[model samples]
Target: MIRTIVGLIIVLALSVVVISSVPDYSLPSGLQGVGQDYTERGVNDTGSVNLVTAVVVAYRGLDTLGEVVVLFSASTAVVLVLTLVPMGANPTPSSSIVAFTSGVLPGSIVLFGIYIITHGHLSPGGGFPGGAVVASAFLLVMLGSNKIPGKSKLLASIESLAGVTFGLLGFWGMMMFGQFLNNMVLPAGSPGKLFSAGIIPLISLVIGAKVASELSGVFSSYRKAGGDE
Candidate 1:
């Protein structure tokens, strides 16, 4: 315990030291430049209404790749935990009130999540937030509907497919554009159209599907283990 505590302290100290040593810049000025440049590029080059999506999926696709890695890591960690500690079956029947509420909630969440992901190029919501919302819906279902057990294998398969697709798409981009995640090959559809922004919508859908599946798997395992009690 002492060694563990010391290690944690050292890690925390290092993090603080690193953060403190970082150079500070005029954040507002930087943001203004970013926004102006993004807007100009969005109109002139991509013609996409959603500058943020253009940035995330095209201009800075590499960052999105890193974000996917983080999600994959989280899913892997959850799977490891579930495998090491077997969860038991559900202990109690879900209350009627909880069931009714949960039933209504998931539909609304699904709708909202879809909207968020689909309109990501036009609004603030994007793949990650949309995915998390879908995951929350799955969590609610797991909590309130014990009768409908989630399929772990199916969820795992979906997660794997999404991850694989993302990687393959990145590789394809590299082959076409000489950069691993460049969106240059994608048809820059008319800016505000639903199909615009090359691979942004597709990537968002993949991320959402993966996150939802992995989260459902995690929740299902916990529910089975009787952890909900």
Candidate 2:
């Protein structure tokens, strides 16, 4: 009862904060400054119908790169810490229902994640969410499988290569266009298509792969630390 009351208080407090902030968020009378520029030219500039993708992968690419680097660093730190510690107690065995669901669900979830990454330039979802979805599928597999899952070495290799490729692509854009992650380095195709948006889709896919690999490695390390074989 105390725990429930505390939870309700926390929720109510957050709700009050959010509701209080709502009045401060009046709709803009008109798009202005960078907002105006992006709305006016994002499609023509990056060939991504999804202006959010254009901003994330083209205009503000460096921010995304920094975020990925932070994620990688944090995962690496956790992995190293785990390596130094003694192995923890073995994990409890999964129930039959969990094992069955893990077996049946991961493959489809992975495919859907790939779809989300590939279509990011045309849709709402992108590399970050796609990668998280894939990682969650791996997490489910680990939680439900009889054995601790994920290949550590393979995940590391993939993660390293994807990180390198991401940097190399940024350099490539710089070489050609005097800017990092320049979307115009390659020809931008027709919008709302599978193979458009120059390097945005490619970078998005790379980000997804790197993020998935990094998270999978972290998950594997955690499970291994629990003395799972």
Candidate 3:
């Protein structure tokens, strides 16, 4: 244990040193103008009021794909942990006040998460933040309802489906426009409208569901373990 801790500290120190030493790089002169170009293209070509969404889903979709993979890995880790332990081995009682708060707060949080996800194409919050919010709501649910069982298989299925759907969507884009994950085929409606961006909202929904289910599954497993004890 001492060696492990020491090794971890050394690794962290090395990472910090290396990361700090990385040279600062600026955008190319022509690329420096890309923000304005992206904004204009977002408004006209993608009809997305939020330039960030346009950049993430349309311009830099490969990065978004990587982010989804990270979320998937998190879900997989949770599933693996839960599977290693038997259910109903430990039970932990939660305070009534906490239960009440969890129940009441999660509803508002769910609504807010949806709002953030849907308006991602028009504002600051996008899939990542929105998905995190949704996961928080699920965590609340797991804490509040002790009797409720987590649907691990279902959650895993949803995560896998979302990942596959994203991949297929990217592949379709490649087939259509010779660029993977391109959103050009989407009908660019009026900027600021709910239906403006074609796949951004869809992707957000998938992300939200994936995050919520995975986190809920993890929380439920932990809660179940506590209940057993």
Which has the greatest lDDT? 2
Candidate 1 accuracy as TM-score: 0.78
- Show pairs that collide, candidate 2: none
When summed lDDT is taken over every stretch of 10 residues in candidate 1, the lowest stretch is: 25-34
Backbone clashes for every candidate come to 5, 0, 11
For model 1, how does the per-residue alpha-carbon lDDT over 1-229 read when each residue is reduced to its tens digit?
9999999999999999998887684446445676788877775465457777778777887787788788779868876787677656565777899889898889999889888888787778877788888888878877786653645577878889998998888888889978886665678777778887777777778777877777777777666556655
Cα distance off (Å), candidate 1, residue 115 = 2.0
The TM-score values for the models, in the order shown, are: 0.78, 0.87, 0.77
Give lDDT tens digits, candidate 3, residues 27-116.
566544777688656677767788877788778889888977886787678768866877664345568997889978988998998888
Residue-level lDDT of model 2, residues 57-163, one tens digit each, is 88999999999999999999999998787666668878888889999999999999998899999988889889999999999898886564544578889899999
- Rate residue 206 of model 1 by lDDT: 78
Report the C-alpha displacement of residue 115, candidate 3, in angstroms: 1.6
- Candidate 2: 10-residue stretch with minimal lDDT: 145-154
Model 3 steric clash total: 11
Q: Which stretches of candidate 1 lie over 4 Å from their true place?
A: 1-35, 147-151
**lDDT per model vs. reference:** 0.77, 0.89, 0.76
Error of 1 at 149 (Å): 3.3
Flag the better candidate by TM-score, 1 or 2. Answer: 2
Ranking by lDDT: 2, 1, 3
